[model samples]
Target: MFNFGIFLLLLGAVLVYATVPIIKIFNITTTKGILVVKLSGLALAVIGAIIMFFAQFPQRLEFLRLI
Candidate 1:
């Protein structure tokens, strides 16, 4: 889970950084296609962040409970 979350975060970052190029590689040939791909990248990044949050939730809860 940890590794996958990290990988997703990186993938999202790359996708966002190279939105148009990646879209072209996928053979989505439209000038406005970048908008959808960029949105998907943002969604992936948010999902990855959620995964990472859950992955560390136990430890965080433990620490919080210590208070």
Candidate 2:
């Protein structure tokens, strides 16, 4: 479950990480389009963070314990 949560967070980050350049790629002519893209990315990140925070990743990663 923890790993799944982390994966989701990373997935969200990837979505957020892609939003700007991808929007720019399509040559959106309006400010509204840009705003919408940014907002969607923000929503994805928030959802990811919610999952990550509730995941308790620290309790599951043995490798982290070694470090």
Q: Number of the top candidate by lDDT? A: 1
How many steric clashes between backbone atoms does each model show?
Answer: 0, 0
**What tens digits encode model 1's per-residue C-alpha lDDT throughout 8-58?**
888888889997678767988776787788877888888888786667545
- Tens digit per residue, CA lDDT, model 2, 1-67: 5666667667667656786677768987688887776677677667777776665666446556432
The all-Cα superposition gives candidate 1 an RMSD in Å to the true structure of 4.4
By summed lDDT, the worst window of 10 consecutive residues in model 2 runs over: 58-67
Clashing pairs in 2: none
Off by over 4 Å in 2: 1-20, 56-67
